[model samples]
Target: MQNGRKQIAVWDVFVRLFHWCLLAAVLISFYTTKTDGAPFLFPIEVHAQAGYIIIGLLIFRVIWGVLGPTYARFSTFVYGPKNTASYAKALLKRQEPRYASHNPLGGWMVVLLLLSLSFQAVSGLFLSDDIFFQGPLYGLLGRDVSGELASLHALNSDLLLILIGIHLVGIVVHALLGEHLVPAMVTGIKRFTSAPVDEKPAYRTKYRLLAIGAFLVAAGVCGWLWFYPY
Candidate 1:
């Protein structure tokens, strides 16, 4: 937590990059759906490109949530059922402790959102619009299987809307309570507390070359899956 412009790094560069990339990918994908069949450069490539980026970000995120900074790692926020229930109770009473990172309930929400988005990404690889935009992984499944996966993908995406709405509501509630959680994520700086909720420990930092390498390799795979069509 920062006190009067004190710098405490809560988010690594990789984390911030992944966050923005995923946001862009999701927005592009939704836009393409809204404007499907529009004629432009390549005439229908943006959604496919966006899907590849979404998957890449999701892969990077899963790896980072396991091995990133102290505040970013899963172990930092993932809590037991008791903690989640306690947080819920506190929220009802308007007394939930504000965490510099994710709170227990919010932590589970993060997990759920990640899992749901990942599932949607994977299923997207195997889904078609039932008309055009058939995925390259379409061959791995029979017609019936592809249809089922497409349905699952749509179902998951619909659920994501509800979850995101809930998250925005939570954010607004926190802001109303004078806790600027959204800025902490955007600026990677949390406001200070007298009782010290969690100490900001500066960990020796370096990007995992292997992760970046693997990401490039995944880009290769994405190309193969999108363009080369096995």
Candidate 2:
């Protein structure tokens, strides 16, 4: 409540941490796998480790989206085709309304990113470099199937870069439209001069402990896959 604006806690602690941690993991994965002549210190093993971290993060996020606070749920942000189209039209006309959670188009982007990253991580589990590195489930699918997944994994990495580019461009476009979107994600608090009409009461559920519990479960599962591989 500064200067007549209402400040609300939109992203929870787990969500904020998840967002940044995922970003870092993605970057590390890409740098280790995609870049040529990269540091010898960061080998393909680092890439595999980052993929495991991403798998754990995505698992926790799916759980949180189901059971976390009001604004964190998929129901709050995932709009349908008509709504997304309408929001796109509004955006082109510069008439889109501000949203406390993700705007309609942004919601779909989040879904796409999640799905894409999930595929990337899961596919990596079947990949191998004949000489030194092998994913946990590298030989489970047989060489032929693993080879196909390896190809898809490479293709999807390009798609991921494209999607990430669009995401960054969207942030810049929002900034140009007078909405500073990144800061809210960083702080987990969003401020508005007038609460958006669609904005719901924030933090209606006590999910902090539940979120932590969910992450531990996710991490344990991913850890088992990382260690056991069978």
Candidate 3:
């Protein structure tokens, strides 16, 4: 603790690692799918692999949101509609209260982003380019249905870009409001200017093994789903 503030461990190692890995996977997926050629000698298969990675990460996150530490739990950040609206109003007035994890509006944004990504990844599994490339589960769904899902996947990709832009803007706003959110995510420590006297976040980084186990289980499921049809 320093400068009239206290530092609390908020994001755990698994959360931070998952966040950055997901970002990397998303970037790879976007580049491979959106461009004619990928950098770093990456092949088109990287796109599907990245989607698989995103699915695995999302699955692990869902489990972690239920069983992780206090600050990492969904209950800590996902607020009700009334509380979300109140937070939104305060945010517009630039007087929203500080939160150790995501703010109310940001929490909902996270949910939307997750849902969008899940759709994109799942739909891509049924896509076919009619060329050298075909998704793993392409034959499972008939051509007409898979073709329709491919179109929706492209549209959702655009929506994801919009959501990502808004997230970046929110990061900028947080920086202007004197909150270094990125660093906290990277370091797993959030500094509070004036923490509640009666309440302190409980440290629970000891669950690192549990986090790993969750990710392994998620990965195993995704692996079977990806390769079982082959």
Candidate 4:
């Protein structure tokens, strides 16, 4: 249960909240999209609202990566492809080291998933089904452009599914190897074997302010997507 002599503040509370919120939003969106024929206003309204909520959570995540805790920042783990290859090789050899934060390969997966989902959200902003919700950007485009964007948006959703699969599999592998990676994300505590003993922790008050600001921006954007259309 313990790996080192010291405890490190790995992930913050807001980061965990955002992660779970995004997961819920994705599940709601999936259910609504998949069961459109069901006779229920709950699914209809919830799906539309959940889509916007997912976008909002993503906005918070991107902002948090820049201005949150040390382990929560992108700069802490976004390594180059070479580093990923080396990490991958180590992983294959069962020699990869556990990190208190995201390892290099895992870190880029975070970036890739976020970026791909960001594109999905951006495309969703312009998508309208004439069924449930009308995207604000729908009015600005002609039928052809709107149609093309809609198709891309539909196809891009599959990418999110694929990315989710990869992420889940990685977590499962870690679990099977006796590593509690998921709990680390949930509880923000991780065990690492080789860290030094007397490292000082730096505290920051700006992170709370940054997370709050991002959450507000996310709320505003999601509200606009739900209630307003151009």
Candidate 5:
């Protein structure tokens, strides 16, 4: 606390790393998938690799959401439907309460984004272009089933684009309200004019070891997925 402002840690290192990595994976996957033979586009192998990485990132995130720091834990941010609806109403009036962690609406958005990405990644595992590229699980399922999953995968990708657009719009809205949402995410620090003098202490533990272990497990899973076809 200094000069009538208190700096609080809102995102830990793992959370920040996960956020940017997932964003890059999603963007790379999108570009590769959409630009099949176009100039300056990555090969389909890159797209498939990105999808595998997304699977690992999602797995690590689900685990971390349970065992991570104060603001990173799912229990600290997820709210009930009633509370979410109330927050939505407040947003319409531009009077929503400022939260140290994710606001209620943003919490739900996070859940939706994670779920959407998970669906896309899983479905991609069984997809096939029938010409040059095929997913790792493409042979396990019959052609018809794989085709259906591929259709769903393409549809979900469109939904993901729409969701991303909405997320950007929300960022703009927050910016208009004088909240530096993007910067806070990048720096992991949120400054408050007057923080609680005796707020509950952060949950401290050997988080570095835990993060390393989780990352190793995720990487191992991804490696298995990548090489299982060979």
Candidate 6:
């Protein structure tokens, strides 16, 4: 608490960990895929491993969205189409409200990012480059079908890159408007100019075991799926 404001814990430890871990995995996968085993000391297999890890992370995120803390839950932030449009209009006019959780536009952005990444990961499962690598599900489909899925995987990767650029731009815009979003994401605490009296205190971060269990389950599933075909 400082300067007539109050500090509230908005993100829990699991949420913060997921955010950073996903970011690192996505960046590593992107770099490895783009370079195609060149310019990096690590083998290209790291790229496929990163993609598998991302699938696990996505599974964890979906479960967390259902059972995680207040602000981390989808019900707490997702808004309807009309409400999102209104918020976008307000944002364009520089009159948007300060939300304790994710704002309407940001909430939808989160959904889009998740969906896009999910598509990319699922498609990657069927992709085969015919040389050095083959996805786990490649043999489950015909060559033609797998080839199409590989194309879709590449296309969606580009789309994800574009979405990532937009996400960064939004962060910069919010920062310029005096919102310290990055810090809040990092520290799990949000500082408000004047705390809302009606806002309930955040639930305690007591789901450490649940998060770890979910991660282990997700990792196990990924591992089995990756190796079972061989």
Q: State each model's C-alpha RMSD to the native.
A: 2.7, 1.6, 2.1, 2.8, 2.3, 2.0
Candidate 4 local lDDT, residue 58:
86
Tens digits of lDDT, candidate 2, 103-143: 99888889999999999999998988887678888888799
Q: What is the C-alpha lDDT of each candidate?
A: 0.73, 0.87, 0.84, 0.76, 0.84, 0.83
Q: Rank by lDDT, descending? A: 2, 3, 5, 6, 4, 1
lDDT of 4 by residue, 117-171 (tens): 7787777766677876677677577878888988887887888889989999988
Q: In candidate 3, where is summed lDDT lowest over 10 consecutive residues?
A: 196-205
Cα shift from native, residue 54, model 3 (Å): 0.7
Which of the two, 5 or 6, has more lDDT? 5
Candidate 1 residue lDDT tens string, 95-207: 77767677887788888888888788788777666554677777587888989987887788789878878888878977887767767777776664543355568545565
The true-structure Cα RMSD of candidate 1 reads 2.7
| Candidate 3 lDDT by residue in tens digits, 1-230 | 88889887878888899899999999989888678644545456778788888989999999999888877778888899999999899889988888878888889999899999999998988987776558878978799999899899989999999999999999999899988989998998888887732234575658778888898988997787657554
Best-matching candidate per lDDT: 2
Per-residue lDDT of candidate 6, residues 1-230 (tens digit): 78778888888888898899999989888888776666666545678778888898899989889987778889888999898899899899998878878888888889999999999888887877777678888868888888888788889888999999989999999899888899999998888887632255677648777788888888887787656553
Clash number for model 6? 0
What's the TM-score of every candidate structure? 0.85, 0.94, 0.92, 0.88, 0.92, 0.92
Clashes of 4: 0
Judging by lDDT, tell me the better candidate of 4 and 6.
6
Candidate 5 lDDT for residue 218: 90
Better of 2 and 6 by lDDT: 2
